[model samples]
Target: MTQSATWDYIRGSDKDGYAIAIATNNTVYESREVDPATALGLTFRHAFSLSDNLLLRSSLSAVHDQTWSRRSDALIWRERLDYDIGPLRLFTSVDTKVTTLNERNIFALGSFLPYPESFVTLSVLPGVLYRLSFGEIGVSLTASRTMFRFETDYLGLRRNNDRVQPNLFASATFWGIKVEGSLSYARVTFPAGDFDNLQRLLYTAKATIPLELFRLPIEKLTLELSSGRTLEDTTLPFSVINVSTLSDARLVAKFNPSHALTVFARRKDDEYVGLGARAVTTSLGAEYAYTFDGGLTAIVAGSWRYTQETGNIPVSSLNLQLGLSKRIDFSRTTTADASRATPAAPTTTR
Candidate 1:
């Protein structure tokens, strides 16, 4: 069983902004069979708008027993800078002491995968983004160098022999809908020999239609359908679990019955992989929420899923959760408001 907790303290100034957070968690037995989770951690984020066109961000974190498979400690630090010109923006970042994954859990990486003990990797990315309101149109591209590491032996590879990869990606949005895509290619250099041609390409397109088509008495009922494919050197397009992430179609229906009541429902299914390949399961779920005029709100959510296994695997599970939360904004901080505060007058000495 593992549970985690996190708290964030954010403060911003006219020229710069800052946030501090801490988090930690504990995993009893740290088993892959079933997960009852608990942990606590905090993070601090800071952004500086040196000018209207220039911005910078930095953050750091520390945790214990946080990784899923490994037994260890972890720390992370990240920094990014961005600048905007006209309708285009350029961004780049450097990050270290973070754990992604080692290609074990094929499903959704960790839509629910356990934390392998805390591990860290150093990476750098530089990208550009553009958005034009002439008609709903947006474009984005990001390239990054990923250097993965392991505190212990991972994926049959030792710790010192880190893999290096250069990732390239681009995406765009159309109208109020989104049609974005990405491509990532890697070069794997092992101490043994060299593996050639390690690459992946991903594409996704989603469109949402207004409720005027269905004539439902609700705030919004969006008709959403999306499809994607990942092409790789070894993994066939949309066949392997690792290759076929987010390979599904989904529909969302939301209704605000009254000023204080809201409800939502959704259904999703996996796209067909191939003629003989195994297919992922499907799920249907619903949620109800109540909110008062105040800032407080309560939500209860649950889901029922059907699973299809290859052998004597568990067929499915009925999962449900109920949570209650109350929110109070101790400090309603803003950029403009904080900026308005008078800067300290230059001290004049006699």
Candidate 2:
């Protein structure tokens, strides 16, 4: 069994072009296949529009895992500047990220290390994009490096790694469906040079579509479809392999018969090339909520999931949950200004 909870708090007005957000997630896992453990994560994010044409964003996140005595932290900073050149829009983006991890019991010198090991990675990306009538096209160069912080560098271990990639990417929306694609050429080198250097061409493409765009007859029914594929390389870590491939597809549908009743279903499939793994999962769920006079809401929900993985038999499980929730809003809003505020952009999860 796995349980998780998340909390998010945001301050500042979107209309003012500045906002700060703090969030935390806590999770506990109990299973026969692995030891029971708990993990906690915290995140802080801030976004400020320096002007109508420029934006600055920063985020910091940290996670601690009790099962492995592991701690990980990451910081990301980004800036974007836009300019209108006649009918076309040109934009420049700068992004930087630093990630560090510390863990005990790391195997070294043919034995488990008593002290903790630390690893650090840094990445920088600068890109320029041009907006077209339907979509945008951009090119970027990324440089990333990783280092091991230990007493001595392991001889011939190839623990330190570096990569330089030049990529071309584009995205467009057509007929209410958004599509994105990218092509990259990556060169990976090891400081020790004991391992062979790698050079590969990687390509990825993704598409998303919402069924509501078709104006279906069904009321209060919503459906979404999304699929993505990475052909020669993947976004996975380079510590495992220099090149990998991944593919996935997902579909989700929801129906609300009334204000208090809702039903949802999801189907997903995933494949990994370098890992030689494939999985499929499907689930259906429903929820009902009742609001009391005092503003507290009682909720009941149930779901059944079926999963199958490569070289494993299929398994199915059913879950039922009950909860109570109350929401409190501290911000003040007027109807006229609320109506004129732009809607927040939709987010996608993979």
Candidate 3:
């Protein structure tokens, strides 16, 4: 069994804002397949308006996880500055991330995989956004560098590598559809020499469309599609290039034929490719919810998934769930109530 709890607080004024959040989770396992674990996380954020047209924001977060006899920790910090002109907005951000794993046992299929040692990454991003009639368009570029160090008694040696990545992204929305695209290039330098440098290129695109079917039983539908391709060129010692591609599509529909019941359906398909292997998966799910008096509701849901892979047999799975829930509103304040509760500022006649 697993249990978790989270709490958050926020304070804001005209020129400055602050927030803090913390979460703690514990998990217990009765079987031998898994080990008990406990984790805690804390985060803080602050924003300040440097001037009428300039704003600064920063955030810091840390997480600690303990499982069995092993422990892991991760920390991250980010800062951003935004400057706004009449019709254009410009922003820049910096991020630092660090992770350490102390001989942690990562279990997969009842087996232990290699435990990661530690890694640190630093990133800088600069972007510009322009408002349009239909929606908004934005372009951003990010440059990141990472150093990964791995050491284990099993390997009997320490290994270190460095990677640099630069990415460009653009996004826009028009005609009730949102589209985004990105291109990334990466170079990995091995401790051996420059001749062992690895180069990689990645391109990705995503789109979301929302529609209303007036004549059908469905009230609303949303469709999402995404695709990506990656190419990797190995070092001179290997002299090999590999290409991989991935595509995903999803659709969700909601229908309300009667006042007491609502129906929803979702479908998704995903396809992937690798050097010598390819796989495709499709999933279909449906749910029916019935509303009762006293804010009580009942839901029944089912899902089916099918997957096929090269040089492997196809697999299928089915799942079903039934649930009952009740709604509780602790705060009875409405917009009018809030407005009435706040005292208006005093005014003086000139």
Residue range 70-121, candidate 2, lDDT tens digits: 4455555665555555545555555555544433322442233344435565
- Estimate the TM-score for candidate 2: 0.64
TM-score of each: 0.60, 0.64, 0.59
lDDT of each: 0.46, 0.54, 0.60
After superposition, the stretches of candidate 1 with alpha carbons farther than 4 Å from their true spots are 1-35, 38-41, 61-74, 100-119, 134-156, 159-197, 204-207, 224-244, 247-254, 257-281, 308-312, 325-350
Please give the TM-score that candidate 3 achieves against the real structure. Answer: 0.59
Full ranking by lDDT: 3, 2, 1
lDDT of 3 at 217: 67
lDDT of 1 by residue, 4-77 (tens): 33334445452476766554444344246644443445567777787889988887866443233223344778
Report backbone clashes per prediction.
34, 0, 0
lDDT of 3 by residue, 186-223 (tens): 66665644224667677888898876644556666767
Weakest lDDT window of 10 consecutive positions for candidate 1: 341-350
RMSD, one per candidate, in order: 10.1, 6.2, 9.7
**Which candidate leads the pack in lDDT?**
3
CA lDDT of 47 in candidate 1? 76
